[model samples]
Target: MAENTKIEWCDHTFNPWMGCTKVSPGCAHCYAETRMDKRLHKVRWGKGQPRQRTGVANWKLPLKWDGEAQKATGAFDESFFNQAKLSQKRPRVFCASLADWLDHEVPTQWRVDLLNLIEQTHNLDWLLLSKRPESWSARLHEAMGGGSELARRWLNGEPPANIWVGTTVENQLLADERIPALLRIPANVRFLSCEPLLGPVNLSAIPTGEGHGLNEAFPRITMNPLRRALRDAPHVHWVITGGESGPNARPMHQDWARSLRDQCAAASVPFLFKQWGEWRPADDRDSDRPHWVGIPDGSEEDFSDSPMVRVGKKAAGRLLDAVEHNEFPQP
Candidate 1:
């Protein structure tokens, strides 16, 4: 429906369909599943569940947005283009927050239609994030094989300018697993969403050393003299890292977020810290307020030694090292 979203990274959220199965640890407390399945009962969420496509009216919303964008930029003088890039002026649409666009179980025709819709929306930037990046090429090939010029460009490894592909990477393990898959696909802007970040991640180096046959499987992800993962030029254009929110939200270590910010800075890539989630540092002034301690009363680790506090999502807010990082990659 092209609804305005509270998500900090995107201007709007559009789902061609509803419903998705849990694929990783990040899906343990998925807000979409909770809202769509548990409360609204719109669709069941699981491996065998049926995916429900949204109404035709919802599908046409992007066309209206693209029309608005065209009107905004159509008459702009050359001076405006010289000052700011066209992508910075356009609104970004998070393609599918409620479902994965690359889900294997979703009807092929639905994905094909969505791709067509994306192709038609010339002025709108579509952010397509998926958990199953490994299936992107196959699913995209199937969708594009249906007489789409955009498909030809994509098959040729030249993705459309408006399409920004990313994958959800919650930890180092997932970072290694999914990122290589995403890097294989050629895209205008490639990114990583480390939301609900469970553990520390080194973007520049692969800790496993094994790389799961990375030398042969993914030649693009190579280790240089500095032991930098990926290429020397930083193939990942942007990085968005944040903690978990909602009930049972896990606490993210302060150093975890800091390390990512530092890595992005060194690589000269755009880094965006979305939120601190429901947990904040225990040493903050807000800790004086009544809140649940991050650790249990009697656990192997002492609660007093815990470095985080459950101050609720609103009060916790989105600040890393006392700085609000709201950076975006230029499309």
Candidate 2:
């Protein structure tokens, strides 16, 4: 468990279990897959690959972090001028970065344990993201029926307040396929991670009828477990966008990130432009801003027509068209 993580979106990353398969184009250059093979010295690709379960000690790490988060909030409170913000400060935890909470192939007991862990860590918001949003809904329902009362709350479509459920959409096809399924899950915060973005995604169409294939994408039944138990509308609350990273990272068009940022703004949803990864916009190439310092150069100019220079994620920073859109779901 890393108390401080390089993933700009969250405070800490806790993998209750690690290891996953390549399910889509987004998995073409998975950072976790490479780490498992080279650094971690773990299993090969595909299902049934060996995953080392994070035991009780690993599960208990966040309690220590909850204490650390309060202390760290002092500096933030002073800067933001928000008094006692620490009390409202819940450290966000990116859960199962190396595994899928929605993978039906994995043992149900493993998910059960992780769900139990999420219940215990009330001070941290767990980002439970998946490539397969459909399976997640099914798997989670199974866990709810057999586990504790807290788990039953999940069955009733009232998952723990601290868990942010989300899905990954690398391109428009996936954005159409996954986002609607994601909205079906009832969580305090519903989100999307459009990293390794391969094409322009029109998130503005997600609601109503504008989005491609969204008309019959998902049944409304996902909204209510008891058919009428819920009245509050859940949607794609937060969006974390970024280009690809690593050796063969793909070039995401500047327009792709821009379109998503616009949609988030219109909807009043949180939009976090995490990074540009291997490519930074051309204008940032000569900037003296500390954030743009020491960024590398790129080769592909045809990826986008309006000048997207590959200066890596660091120099590109988290700015979308010179504006930092770091919004998160409120309550």
Best by lDDT: 1
- Each candidate's root-mean-square deviation in Å? 4.3, 7.3
Cα distance off (Å), candidate 1, residue 167: 0.6
Candidate 2: worst-modelled 10 consecutive residues by lDDT: 221-230
Badly placed stretches (over 4 Å) of model 1 are: 75-86, 207-221, 224-234, 284-306
Global CA lDDT computed for model 1: 0.78
Write one digit per residue (lDDT tens) for candidate 1, span 219-330.
3434321123245432678889998899878777777788899988876778899998998777657546654444421122223444787888888888887899988876
Question: What is the TM-score of each predicted model, taking all chains together?
Answer: 0.86, 0.79
Residue-wise C-alpha lDDT for candidate 2, range 1-331, written one tens digit per residue: 3446878888789887777777888888888878876677775656877666766887778777765764665433333422232223667888877777777667777888878877765556788889998776578667876575566787676667667888888887787778777766667667789887777787545532224356666643322211111344556667889888888766777877888887666666668888888766666344552322232122222443555555666765777767877776664
Total clashing pairs for each candidate: 1, 2
lDDT, model 2, position 299: 22
Clash pairs, model 2 backbone: 277-313, 279-310
Clashes of 2: 2
lDDT of 2 at 84: 32
Model 2 off-target regions past 4 Å? 67-88, 145-148, 207-232, 283-304
